[model samples]
Target: MLNKSEISFSFVFSIIVMAELICGSVESLSTYHYFTKPSILISLIFFFWKHAQHLDAKTKWLTLLALLFSLLGDVFLMFVNASANYFISGLLAFLLAHIMYVLVFLRKKKNSKKVLPFTALLLIYAATLFYFLKAGLGDLLIPVIVYMGIILLMAITAFLRQGNVTKNSFILVFLGALFFITSDSLLALNKFYEPLPFSNISIMLTYSIAQLFIVFGLLKQS
Candidate 1:
């Protein structure tokens, strides 16, 4: 059981995470058209800072690297309006962040049991990418392909780690990653294809759900 101070810290961190989700949702919905990279980077930095003293050494380092890569990703996305290179840079940064997540999760689960399903998902994602490669997303093909590969690895690692973690925490993290993927996929589809009805709403909804699960999972583990 956690002491009063620890519980209080958890509550505060939860609030911050919740606030970030709310802001992210609002940004996505308003179509305010501004990049959310700065705010997201700030939130990640604060999240790591707030929990720095409490995290295990390995977790602390991994989390820090994750945030750093996320910040780079954010900056890369920001350049989307300016140059194609920026978008690629952002994708690469996010890929690195996903790799960092895999490392962190793998540390908790040393054994490898389930890998086939993950490979199938990656193959499917690759097929989807190939289908879209020449459809105005010509320059984005390589970066997006690499990003999806890393994300697939993270999902697999997260799923495997779930077996070793507490039930609630595992569910939270797994579901959170699912929601995050849903949000990103929607955004990508919107960018490459025609916009769907309620697209903004759908993106925001999934984004919030994803953040909620991730924050709660971390807090529970803490």
Candidate 2:
């Protein structure tokens, strides 16, 4: 069970997530994501740094940087209307963030046969998404493929934590990875293909919860 401090901390961030989702969901209020979106990752970074002091330096820094890059991605994406370049920048930032997660999840991990099945599933998912996205991807074809591959690898690494970490940790991180995938899939589908109905709400809702799940999973290690 969470102590008082952790409980309060969660409550505060939960408000931020709700506010951001509300702001993002409405067309008129979307610009407010500039404030609320970054707030999400900033709270996460602080929470992570606080609880992760017990972690080895490498793991701690990697996790911290991942959150940092995600913040950068959020900021850059908000400017995407100004230029496609901002979208690319945001994509790169998230790619780096996913790479950091892949590295962090690889720490002291165990080999498992589950890797193949999980990887195959992700590949099929990626390939099918790409099939729809390929026509619209245009100049971004390579970058999108690479980013999708990294996130898939990140999820696989999260699953590989099984048999090595506590069952709770494995479950939390694995679920987090899956949620992250869902959030990004909705995002890509909405942006690159047909616009999803209420995509903003669905995207931010899953994304906010996904980050919390991953952070809570890491904290469980303590």
Global lDDT of each candidate: 0.65, 0.88
What total of clashing residue pairs does each candidate reach? 0, 0
Most lDDT-accurate candidate: 2
TM-score of each: 0.72, 0.95
Candidate 2 has its poorest 10 consecutive residues by lDDT at: 1-10
For model 2, what is the alpha-carbon lDDT of residue 34? Answer: 78
What is candidate 2's TM-score against the reference?
0.95
Model 2, global lDDT? 0.88
Per-residue lDDT value at 50 in model 1: 69
lDDT of 2 by residue, 39-104 (tens): 999999988888887788998999899999999998998888899999999999999999999999
Name the Cα RMSD for model 2: 1.5
